[model samples]
Target: MKLTLRLGKRLNRSWQVDAMLMLLLGVFGAFMAIPLIYVINNAFKPLDELFIFPPKLFVRNPTFENFGDLLQVMKGSWVPFSRYIFNTFFITAAGTAGHILLASAAAYPLAKHKFRGHKVLFTIIVLSLMFSPHVTAIPNYMIMSSIGWIDSYKALIIPAFAFPLGLYLMKQFMEQIPDALLEAAKIDGASEYRIFWQIVMPLVKPAWLTLLILMMQMLWGADGGSFIYSEQLKTMHFAMGQIIQGGIARAGAGAAVAVVVMIVPIVTFLLSQSSVIQTMASSGMKD
Candidate 1:
């Protein structure tokens, strides 16, 4: 199939094609955004509006009743809402920070240094991505139990450091850094650690920011991954689940919880998505 081209001094695709593509993309984007828009609208909806027969996509009677009701319900719980908030924040902060440092450190050697079994090791990491986390869930649970990490923060934070996709993206992005930079640092008597911390880390800002967004999204929505059995160790996601499961009377409050759950990740993505895209543009080759 041939696309029509027009000459405006230099030849280019016709405006008709560009407009068609944009129209299609606009329609697709609207379709994908419907659920998020519904969630936001439902959060402010009163109980009567929520129970309307032949329910509407948009809220007609918007109010903060849902949030107020949500607060009331949370207050009735055995554990305070603030404790769950702290648990979620701590896990997300620790997990994201650790994953960034460890994945970057691991990627630097794989991208810049030549050593035995390097290709085999990276190939294994790439292949690991093809498998789902559920595949190893049983073994992971057994190991956590045996190691006494169950019902603890370590069970949540430590495993995140070895995230396969994080290492993969970091390594691919690091390959764009020229070897001469590291060589020059070495010639000046810089240790490998010094070269990595001072020389390499500074140049990979975009990559780490990109990884930060990815890891933040993952760890932010985490529900302890079934590893923590204690109520105090549960994250915000677990609290959201409990709220939403409270049957029809609590539906308004549930919507409020859902809205609150969605806000942080969306704000985080809005902040870091540009840097993620910039780094991804150059993350095409591996050394």
Candidate 2:
């Protein structure tokens, strides 16, 4: 497919095929956005509107009663709602930050330096991404159980720091950083640590931001699964699950709870969306 490029410093006429592709993309975007809009609309919809025949796409009569009901439900919980909120935020923040730092650190050497086993090491990491997390759940549980990390934040945070996808993406992005830049820093007497911390990391801001968005979304919605037996250690996602399992009377509140659960990741994405786009656009390119 041929795409029309804009002329330098000026608007240019679009090719007919390019215009058709743009129109198709616009339609696809709208199709993709429907679920998000529906979720937002549901949070404001009354129960009558929710169960109406044919099921309206948008809210007919919006109200805050659902949020009000959600607050009441949360207030009735044996554990304070604030505790659940704290656990969720604490886990998300720690996991996302640690994953970015560790993934980036591990990626740098694999990317810029060719060690004896670098190819095999990177290939292993890439292959690890092929298996779903569920495939290793039993092993993870056994290890966590053996190490006594079960029911603790460490079970969630520590494992996240070694996420292969982050390392793979970070390594790929870092490979795009020219070797001459690192050599220049070395010639200026920059220590390896200084080169990595001050020079390399700043240059890969877009890649790390993309990782932040990815990790934040994954870790934020974590329900602690089998690893967390303690209620106090549970995340907002767990609480949301509980609310959603409520019968029809709780429908409105469930929508509100869904909104609460989704907002953080959406906000994080919005903040770094441009950087993510840039990283994704050029990630396949190399020096």
Candidate 3:
């Protein structure tokens, strides 16, 4: 009877610990959510309301005027916002697709095939990740200039395809696949290419989706504000900057643009990977 009582006490203590941890996590989550809520609320508020003393937290006259003003500015701007969107879309799509294809193909050989220098090559690739993009920016700029790719999509898209981090990630994910599966395919007269395309790609869907989400976030949030501004190309962020500098009358418009820009990537991310996020979280735990 004494031992049963002791076990019950220990179980109760464990439950109490779990409840306390959950409460702490809830509080942490609320803290992180505050900034996002503030931004969203301010986006809907008028300029005067934003600067009002004590700050308007829950009360504000929400209006679509900010959105209208932003659209008007976009229409009047010298830079073609539509064209900039197209340009960014092309660069992001080409870069992402290229990264996935090349990285996955390269990873397959490294992970599955036996070859001399494979480890050395992978080591070099991993080491390359340590090199900051800023360190090579000057050299890359010179090369791009020499190749006459300056102020062109090629300048952005081509270089992005060479992401060492993507390659390393694909390699690590592929390593989890069993070697016997490939061997069985080979015994059945399947070529290495067929095995990879038909068999391996499907199994690593979670990893691929995770990488896709990451790549999209990187490309979408790119510091193209400066590059586009300097080149006189009107990206959404550049357009927003122009609005911000216009005057207080345009503050609401700037906020509107900011809200739109922020929402697009976030919505795209959530919609595309809502299912995959759970898979990634669980898989990562196993690792």
Candidate 4:
């Protein structure tokens, strides 16, 4: 039997090379973990240690005072800290769910079915990815203002609903689904809706789970931008920024805030990392 050249049998040609590569990977992994370790250590460091001459990688004397300070700062805010937490959760959930559904729905026909102007439509989506979000900020603000969505959660959630990258990823992943599977379902008396919801969507689980990580990172970091004016509507990220900007006194508290803000996105990635790895492995992408 012949083996496919690209399916990774190449890695087994030399055991010594494999051992060397594993060592190399372990070294790189440790390097990558440095920042995460530093953040965790810094958050627990005392205020005095934070200003040491050359700084330290690890905390010599750890303390929970920073977390306590964070709590006090949260309590000092006029808006309840829970409100900011709620707003962040709501926006992240709503935006992520909507983008997944909308992108998956739009991707279905584009991936499996041919239609008029399909190529043109997909071209536009691809083109949109070339521009950074900052380039669209002014236009997005104008649209939000005109729609009276400013100062509301709609300003935050609605703008992220039509994420082009989500659709791009979904469509690419969906293209790998064999059309024969859908045809088999059709022959079994499944409607188009049933085939999509049950067949296509489930097969693309990795794709959306990966998309969830991406969307969570974006929405989790949202800071109300220029649209939100209402104090109650601000996200936890926006509130954290306020707490982080209190100069030298807030240094420890700022480190604590960084840890807090990173929690959700890191957790989301950890939960979905296997799916993401599966998706990437099957993607057949090359450098």
Q: Pick the candidate with the highest TM-score.
A: 4
Local accuracy of candidate 2 as per-residue lDDT tens digits, 82-141: 999999889989998999999999999999889899999988998999999989999999
lDDT of 2 at 194: 100
Best by lDDT: 4
Residue ranges of candidate 2 with Cα displaced over 4 Å: 1-19
Between 2 and 4, whose lDDT is larger? Answer: 4
- Pairs of colliding residues, candidate 4: none
User: What do the candidate models score in CA lDDT, each in turn?
Assistant: 0.88, 0.91, 0.76, 0.92
| Alpha-carbon TM-score of each model against the true structure | 0.90, 0.94, 0.85, 0.94
Total clashes for model 1: 0
Give residue 59's lDDT in candidate 4 (0 to 100): 100
Ranking by lDDT: 4, 2, 1, 3
Q: List the residue pairs that clash in candidate 3.
A: none
How large an RMSD does model 2 have?
Answer: 2.6
Ten residues in a row with the worst lDDT in model 3? 225-234
Per-residue lDDT for 149 in model 4?
A: 92
Off by over 4 Å in 3: 1-18, 53-59, 223-234, 272-287
User: Candidate 2: lDDT of 25?
Assistant: 100
Off by over 4 Å in 4: 1-11, 285-287
